[model samples]
Target: MPTRPRSSSSARISSAIVVAATLVAVPPAALAQSGEVNVYTYREAKLVAPLFEAFTKDTGIKVNTISASSGLEQRIATEGANSPADVLLTVDIGRLKEAIDLGVAQPIKSDVLDKVVPAQYRDPNGLWYAASARARVVYASKARVAQNEITYEELADPKWKGRVCIRSGQNIYNNALFAAAVAHYGEAKAEEWLKGLKANLAQKPSGGDREVARDIAAGKCDIGVGNTYYWALMSEREPDKKAWAEATKVILPTFQGHGTHMNVSGVILAKNAPNKANGLKLIEWLVGEQAQKIYADMNFEYPIRSGVKPHAVIAAYGELAADPLPIATIADNKKKAATLVDKVGFDN
Candidate 1:
């Protein structure tokens, strides 16, 4: 919600130092062109900014971004009848579905979106569609773990006891993974799997996906569950991250059976988006081959569009079967999935 004053480039450069002093002075409209598209997202700013800049370069459209905010839903709701945002981008189908349920997102009627995004990956009503996907899989230390193959239900084996690492169960990513399980097996069986998983923890689930990878490399645990994209990011960003990669082999679970659990970061047009033509144009540009490639390179995720090759690191992980569950199912059952998490004590 912070607004920068409208000024020449030189003045804009100078004001960076006076940001605190300028904070109380202006409304966003005073700073922005009326035709700009506003985006609200949880994606890390570095990962998305360049893409937005590229979109601008291609089309001469201006994008005003608000990244990494916590109260996005409330912000969208508050913008209400007078909302300025043209697009909403966020990770996880849960949030996308929430936007639809709240009536903040309106169905887009783009033929490009329909053809390229895949039928199961998007809302039937077109409230939102994915740009890219990330896989959730297990990582096993090369030095200690000897199993060549494993299943999601096999984590409970006595050999892995006190050696599994994961992030907090409250995270939506983990909840979605569990929901994928629910789709495969009934609730009673999924709860049994959760109980067994808790019994075998390397330590209590405590950190981000990178942290889980770090623990495996540090010899604190032999196996961990984390999103696949983080592995590539870590390997590219820090040398120590490579150590983690070297120590473990990515095991995309359910490959031979149900396929790996996956999730997406996607975009939706606002229900009352003022500039609908520009919005449609922007959506087309995002799902285009060039934009999809940028997403793959920056984040180590798969392009939702077919035939676009993933990044080198992701290719090294090798391809695996993806689950066939309609992604909307994960969004639809998210609340029920959360209740199951609590009922079964995944946090404990």
Candidate 2:
């Protein structure tokens, strides 16, 4: 893991210190040309390190990573033609699109990516590809909510009023789900649905997905919408949070019969990637069965590859019949989605 460092305002403030903290260093021109890839990522260092290591072990190519919370797109833009970024690793389609919008990423034609990732999970132009997925699902009180099945529309039903606990509707996760709603139902009905769901809030929309589980366990609410992996994390990896998982059960909710709304952790190729070949190799490797298994087993995420299965811990949630809606279609509605979020004062 890269050590935390203070960031200076200027783009050249040495990325190693802040916006560009590198986990492993290979002098730009020398090692990059020989056998190394420079990666600028938004994912946590610990989460992606193993995959990088395995890639290195298998191919004998070096991996150097610069991890960040935000501004990677802008940073790459500032560096322009001189940028060493080979790949941009990020969690959401919105961020992936942002990199493209900033003109820092370029499209790549990869047969491996085209074959492994579904059409809905990648850019039609091949700009980015999702490596793994997670569904927006319900964590319902095991003791209170008896039925296993529920729909996204049902959250607005009067019976669930004053019972739903959720994070800020403005968060990217919820925005994606809400955007899916807008795409599925169109603007007018989507707004009405948001208003209804907001009216059913147990309290103000607040907290992360795990806290939603915590709140449900405390009986603060009867049900909450969260991602798939948090329940698995609580059940196995996080002993301290086991009671939260025990107090609730995962319910796969759909948009009517459209199937569960899903999101992804994805990657992009940098326009000025100095080690473009290595970067492409890494991207292709990520969707291969080996890297897919590492992602599934270690990250508790659903693999993007066709035949690979999710970690047993996550698979126990039940089959994730993901909605057929193109993720980009849902992401495209982000502006309208956020507008609806504020229009309804969902957080209030």
TM-scores for every predicted model: 0.88, 0.93
C-alpha lDDT of residue 303 in model 2: 92
For model 1, how does the per-residue alpha-carbon lDDT over 1-348 read when each residue is reduced to its tens digit? 122334467344433221211201223552234545667666666677778888889988877666533445455666686776677788787778778877888889988999999987888888889988988889888888887677787876676789999987778788888888777777888788788888889787888888888899999999999888888777787685788777788887772367778898888887767666677778888899989999888778889988898998888877767887888987776777788878878777
The candidate that wins on TM-score is 2
Worst 10 residues of 2 by lDDT: 1-10
Residue by residue across 87-120, what tens digits does model 2's lDDT show?
9998777788788788887898998899889999
Would you list the C-alpha lDDT of every candidate in the order shown?
A: 0.76, 0.87
**RMSD vs true structure, all candidates:** 6.2, 2.7
Report how far residue 184 has shifted in candidate 1, in Å: 1.5
